[model samples]
Every structure is written in C-alpha cells, then in structure tokens.
Target: MSATKQHPFYKSLTVAVLLVWTAAVLYPLVWTLFGSLKDNQQFMLGKPWALPKFPLLWSNFSYVWETYGFSGYFLNSAIVAGASTLLSVLLAATTAYILARFAFKGSGTLLNLYLSAMMIPMILGLIPLFFLLNEMHLINKLVGLIIVYTASALPFGIFVLVGFFKTLPRELEEASAIDGAGYNRTFFTVMLPLAKSGLVSVGIMNALNIWNEYIMGTVFINDPSKYTLPVGIAIMQSEMQYRTEWGPLFAGLLLSMIPVIAVYVLFQRQIADGVTAGAVK
Candidate 1:
C-alpha cells in the first residue's frame, strides 16, 4: 500500500499525538501562571488546572521580592551572567578568528585540543577550581562567579564561533585588505557586523546558562547577599518547606524566567538567522 491513502489512520494518530504534546508543553506554563496568582491555601486546595479568582498577582510578587531578597539576587545574577557572556563572546570571537583564518603549525592539533576539552565534565573540575579560587581569595565573590561562568562557557562558544567564522567568505577579508584595511579593522568593521547574529545567539545561550547555574554558585558563594536567582530560590524553597508557600515560589519562578524569555523573544529573528546560516554554511 502506497503511503497517504493507505495510512489515513496513521495520519489521525499523528494529529492526536501532536495535540497531546502541545497540551503537555503548554499546561505547565498555564498552571504556573495561575498558581502565581493564588495563595498558599488556594494553590493546594484548588484544582491544578483551575484559574485563580481575584488573582493576587501583585501580592505574590511583592512577597517573593521581600521574602527571597529577589532584588539583590536579580542584580547579582544580571551582573555575573552579563559580564561572563560579554567576556566569553569577545574572547571566543578572537580565538575563533585565529583558528578559522590562520594556518599555523599544529593548528589542527590545537583545534582538537579545544574540542577535547568540551568532553570533560565540568563537575570533575569543581574541587580543584574551588581550591584554586580560594587561593586567589575569590570565593564568595561575583568576580569569581563571572570568571567561572566565562571559563565554563568558553569551549562551546569557541567551537560554535569557529565553525561560523570558517564559513565566512575569505574574499571579504581580501577585499578589505586591498582597500588598506588592517586585520583588526576588517574583522571589526566587516566580519563582526556580518557575524552579529552568531554572536548574539552565543551570548544569549551563555547568559541563560550562567543565570540558571546552581551547583557552582551554591558551592562558591556562601554569602546570601551574593546568591544568584537559582541559589536564592533554592534557599527560599528550603526555608518555606514546612509551610510550602506556593504563591511566592511560583511568582519567583515566573520572575526568574522573564529575562530569559524576553531575550529569546527580542532576538528571535537573529537567533533563527544565526542557526540557519550556521547550518547552511
């Protein structure tokens, strides 16, 4: 039996599967949104799928802000993620340019080394990293967190950028050179602009990763004031476990997600272009 006509049942089954998948994905976000508006009692007593009546959205948000010290955590997270992403992208761009454009002795070996580093699990490095950071007296500091985030992101960022840069036309560089543009000028004025989409994509990914990271932040930053969103939320959860205050927790979760979602939405076009270009090239 030749496909479509004979597989009418299969088509119906596929449609049903897709509907279920869509509901599965969307239900949690809808539930969380509703839950954020409910008090601790209502959240537990009401149906999981029910919408809130007289939604206490503002109260819940206010509670989260005060109870979790969310303002401080938000600022700390923004600083660390932003600094790390900026540093990583700049360093990645330079390193990627060298790897992609230059043909030096043992270039392949060096590239392979970078690739190999990616395979090593970050957890394995934590103990030694912590000890080293302690020696530098960087423990419990935002700078140390930024440094760790930058280092952790560098390998994958460089790998992605290297591929993107390699796909760029060499003719552009040669044309710039003929016009008396130096390497720095050509890279900054020509290549970087052309590669803006890729840089944005990499930077956004690094920002999200750093912002959500809990393990390293928890271990390295003992001060509550220095805690990022993830760690602060975790602390809130632990403290409120007996009472189980769902309202503030849900509100906090929603707040934590806003920046990441906003970034993806704002740069949606650039992210799409970057992925498409990277794939095509």
Candidate 2:
C-alpha cells in the first residue's frame, strides 16, 4: 500500500475546527445537565462551571414532570409531532412518487406549486390561517395543531422525497407492474419500501421541527392543558420568575431534548445515506 500522503496543515485545521464546534455544542448541554441537579441559588450564584453539590437533587426532574405539567405537555407534543410526521411524510411520499414517475399535463405545475410553497414564509399566512382555523372551529385544539404542523411540513418533505423517488431505478416499478401490482400496491409495497431511507430522513426532520416549533404552537394552542413542549417550556420559563425553581426548569429543558437526540442516534445512518444518495443522483 502507498504510504499515506497527509496534508498536515489541512488536517490540523480540520481537527481544530471540529474540536471548537464540538465544544461549543457540548458545553451548553453539559452545563444544563449539571445545573438541573442544583436549586435556583446554586445555578445563579455558584460557579456556572462547577458540578452540582454532593446531594444532587434528582427530584427536580420529577417535580418538573408532575408539578409543572411538563408531563402532559410532553405527551401532547409527542402526539402532535408523531401524527404530523406520519401524515405529512405519507402524503409527501405519494405526491413525490406521482411527480417523479408520471408525465402528464400540469404534473410539473403541481410539483412547482409545492416547491413554491416552501419559499412562502409560514409567518405570512398566520392571519389568514388563524381566521380559517377559527371558522373551522379548530382554535386551541390539538387536532388543529396537528393539521397545521402536517401541512407546514409537507412541502419540505415532498422536496426531499421527490429526489429519492427520481433516483430509484425504473426497473423496480416495471417488475412490480409486470407482477400485476396496481399503482397503489406498487407504491405501497415496492416503491415505498425502496425509499425507506429518504422517508425516515424526512420523517425525523419533520418530527424535530414539529417538536421544537414555538411560534405555531404558541399561536394555535391557548389552553395550558394542550400546550406542546416548546410553548409549555416558554410558559413555564415565564412563570419561573415568580416561582424561582431554576433547577427543575433546566431539568424540563433537558427532557425536551431527549426525543430529538434519540432520533438522531437511532436513525443517523439512514439519514446520511439518504442525503448523499439523493445528492449524487
């Protein structure tokens, strides 16, 4: 084997950049984890970099989970994000499949419309959306939020999955057709499974967006009982000035991050594979 030809300067620079970025991202999470074990005073007054005192208060998580209603909010967010991701990704995959496979009048237009929808800042639709939802009697409802989240996530999902669908070998669909599979059957059983990587990629992204989304969540959900985690956390933070339990607040924040982290940990390989495959094609 040829001796490794190392570009020392470039290698050193790359390592330095990675180390800096890693530290920047990791420090805050570490600090937050440590702060969760202390009370408000220690978090505020004690050295910000120090570890928690000997008797780390694990009850802080329980307190945030129960006393502050994060449990309900967390569950509400899970339902909203989960439902929205599933519905949006399913719709997007079907839409993408048709656009990628079929050549017909206005198919391009339809795809273009979804692409254009991505450019329109969701904020621009807020006033009209509110009125429309209110007229539909969906204000402050979890179902309303689910629909809103699903719709908001659709365009991006379609954009990503369309590329994957286009990249798929046409022979797969041809074979499925020769086997007497209809369009729906071919799509659901063959094409869909083939595009699993891209679907998971978009689904995880949509879930993360829906989970962490604040503005739409805050606007649509008014009842505290129905609040999603981000909105609920903001509400809790606002109330914290009066209650002053910083440790449990940090605990709540940490809990909110677990889902996104877990998703990336579990499906990161598929996400990377989907991205590069879509890109190369």
Candidate 3:
C-alpha cells in the first residue's frame, strides 16, 4: 500500500479515538453546565443530556452562593492551597538544590527515605496525624490544612524538582561562584530563574490537589467556615433531604472547578515545557 493511502486510515483512527476521549471527558461537564440552568421540574422530568427549556442560571448560582456558604469555602480553599503551594515549592526548591548539587555519605539514603515516604498511603497516617494535629491544637484551622497540604505535597515536589535541578548545567553555578557569588546568591539568581517552569508545574499540581482535597479537610476541619470547597460541596449534597437541588448543586460543582481549570490553562505552556525539559535529560 502507498504511504498516503495508509496515512488516511491512521488519521481517521486517531480522530475517532480523540472524539471518543473528548466525549468521555466533556459529557459530565456539559451535563453539569446544562443542569445548573435547569429548575427542579426540568431536572426531574427531562433528560440530563438535554438543555433546559427554562434557564434558571442566575437563580441556581445565587442559591448556591447564598445558602451553601460557597464563598467562605472557596476562600478557605484558596488560602490553604495558596499557602501550601508557596511553602512546599520554596522548601522543595531549596531541598532539591542541596540534594542535586551536594554529595554526602548519607545522600543516597536520604533520597531513599523521601521516596519511601511517598509509598506510604495517606490513609494509613490519618489517625496518627489527626491525633498529632489535635495535640498541637491545629485542628479546624486553615493553618493546619496548609501544614498538612505542604507536608503531603513536599515529597513529590522534591522528587520532580531534584530531577530538574540535576539537569541544569554545572558551569553556570561555577561561573557565578568564580565571580564571588555565594551559594544562596547563585541558587536564587541563577538556578531559580532557570527552574521557574518546573517550580510552576509542581506548584500548580500541588494547588490543584490541595484545593480539591476532601478526606483531610473533612476530618481535620469541623468548623463550617473552615471547610474547603470539596467538603462544603459534599455537605451541600448531604443536606438535601426530600428533593435534591440538582441545579444549584451542579452550579456549585461547576463554579468550584473554574479556578482549577483557569490555573491549568494559564500555566499550561510552562507546565508542558517543564515536563519536556525534565524528560529530555
């Protein structure tokens, strides 16, 4: 068979696969968007895939925001995730730099210890962690959540950043050192700027994870005002007894996803470049 003839079949196959994948990914989001515009009558009587005949868009969003306390939850989520991302990335960058650049007798063992931490399931540590937090009087607080999130995200961040830092040319640091630059100055001005893409990628991933975290948020935070979006949304679902407010619930769900999607879209290029750069070396 000619190359051109085979290419068309391969192209057709790729298109078909992509279409199916897109549908699978978008169906729930589309359904949720339409559902958020539907009233109870439409939700109960009509197909989920169908658009609402009478759009209650503003009403659904208003109800969710006003009644469900989504604003507070959203704010809490943002604070926790943002603080955690900042702290985790800073710590990871410093730690990864040391691990990547320095050679010590126990360096390999230390790296193994960090990797081992990743293998331990979070659930297994939940009980002890809860007790520890309680003893420290950090329960039901944003700071506590930030602490947990930073700790949880640190291992992966360090691993990824170490790999990225290792790929950086040693000559740059040597050149800086010869010009009277100290370790801190060289790292801050030279390595950090070069590693911006990788740091951003790690931060975005950590932020997304923390923002949508449920189990830790639920267990640690009992205060309604301190609840993150995921826990708050779940609470909203549970509060509905006689009839579910599908419209408002879906509206809240859609609204909650906005930040995550926006962050990904905004930093997508950096994330892509970071991953590619890391992989190349």
Candidate 4:
C-alpha cells in the first residue's frame, strides 16, 4: 500500500469517527431543546422523538426562572462559582510561583502534600467538613460554601499552575528584579500576566465544577433561597413525581448549560494551550 493511499484511508476514517462523535454529543442537546419547547401533553401522549409542536412555549424559561425561583438559584451559583474561582486562582498562582521558583526546606513537602490532597475524594471529608463548618457557624451560609469551594479547588489549581510557572523563563523574573520590581510587583506585573492562559484554564475548570456541585449545596444549604442551580434542579426533579413540569425542567437544564457552553466556546483555545503548556516544557 502506497503512503498516499494509506493516508487517505486514515483521513477518511478519522472524519467518519468525528462525524459520529459529533452526532452523539449534539443529539442530547437538540433533544433537550425540543423537549424544552414542548408542553406536558406532548411528552405524555406524543412520540418521544417527535419535534417540538407549533407555537413554541418560550414561556417555559420565564416560568422556571420566575415562578420556580431558578433566578435565585442562578444568582447563588454565579456568586459562589465566581468568588471561589477568583480566590482559587489567586492563591494557586502565588503558591505555585513560590514552589516552582524558590527552593527551600519543606517547600517540596508542601507541594507534595497539595498533590496528595487532590487524590483524596471530596466524599471522604464531607462529614467532618460539615461538622467543622457548623462549629464555625459557617454552615448554611454562602460564605461557608465559598470557603469550602476555594479550599477544595486549590489542589488541582496548584498542581496545574506549578507546571506552568516552572515552564516560564527564570530570565523574566531576573529582568523584573533588575528593573527595581519587588517580589509582589514582579509576580503581579510580569509573571502572572505571562501565565494568563494557565489562569484562565484553572478558573474555567473550577467554575464549572463549583457551578455543577449538588452534593455540597444540598448538604450545607437548608434555605431554599440559598440553593445553587444543581440543588435547585434536583429539587425540581423531586417535585416532578407529584406534578411533572417537563418543559420548565428542560428549560432550567438548558439555562444551566448556556453559561458553561459559552465559557468553553470563548476560551477553548486558552484552555487547550494552558493544559499543554505544562506538559511541553
């Protein structure tokens, strides 16, 4: 078999596989969109695979947002996810920078400790953490949840950013020092900006994880008003047994997905580059 002939075959196979994969990924989203536009009668009596009927019910979204209180859930999620991501990235960047650049006693051990912490499942610590937060009078508070998320996200962020910091040229720091920049100045004005891609990757990943987190929200939040989107969605599901509102439920789901999809689409290039930055160097 000639190289050119084999190349075409592999290329064709790759394209075929990608096409199939794309369909698999897109079908559920399309189905969800169709489901969201439908009424309860359509789902109960009509074909499962049928397209949405005429006069799409866009009010489903408004109903879920206002009547069902997804607006509150969305706001809570945004605040928690945004705050946690910012704190995690800031702390991780500093910690990673120090660990990567400076060699001192116990620094390696500290880094290793952080790396090992990531290996421990969050479930293992949930019980103790709940009690600890309760004792601190932080349980059922957004502040508590934010603190928990920030702490939990730290290990992964540090692990990723350590590699990124290491990849950056030492000469940059040296050059900054020569220009009369102090440690904080150099880090903020020079090194941090250079690691923007890594920061973006870490921020987005942590945001997504926190936004979708249901277990913690359900466990810590007692007030319905304090519920995150995932917790809100779960509540909505439970209520479905008594009175199913499939349209609003699907609409709620679609609403949850939009921010995540938007983020990935906008910063996907940065994410790819950041993930690979550490590996290549």
Name the candidate, 3 or 4, with the larger TM-score value.
4
Report model 4's TM-score to 2 decimal places: 0.96
What stretches of model 2 exceed 4 Å from their correct place?
Answer: 1-5
Query: How well does each candidate superpose onto the true structure, as a TM-score?
Result: 0.90, 0.94, 0.94, 0.96
Per-residue error at 132 for model 3, in Å? 0.7
Model 4 is weakest, by summed lDDT over 10 consecutive residues, at 272-281
Candidate 3 C-alpha lDDT tens digits along 1-281: 77976797888998999999989988888888888888888767757667777545668898899899999988888889889999999998999899989999999888878878889888788999999999999998888888988999988888888889998899999999999999999999999999888998888888888888899999999998888999999999999977788889999999999998898879888777776665564
Candidate 4 lDDT by residue in tens digits, 1-281: 77876797888998999999999999999999999999999988867679989999999999999987999999999999999999999999999999999999999999999999999989888899999999999988999999999999999899889998987899998999999999999999999998888999899889989988988888888888899999999988887788789989999999999999899889899888877775565
Summed over model 4, clashes come to 0
Model 3 segments more than 4 A misplaced: 1-6
Show where candidate 4 strays beyond 4 Å: 1-6
**Where is the poorest 10-residue window by lDDT in model 2?**
1-10
Candidate 1 residue spans exceeding 4 A from truth? 1-16, 44-49, 55-57
Alpha-carbon deviation at 115 in model 3, angstroms: 1.9
**Which numbered prediction scores highest in TM-score against the true structure?**
4
1-281 in candidate 1: lDDT tens per residue?
Answer: 67775687988898999999989987887788788888766756756567787745669898889867999999999999989999999998888889889999988888888878889988899999999999999999999989998998888777778878898899999999999999999999999888787898888888888988999999899999999999999999998868988878889998998898788779888777775676566
Computed on alpha carbons, the lDDT of every model, listed in order, comes to: 0.87, 0.89, 0.88, 0.92
Pairs clashing within candidate 1: none
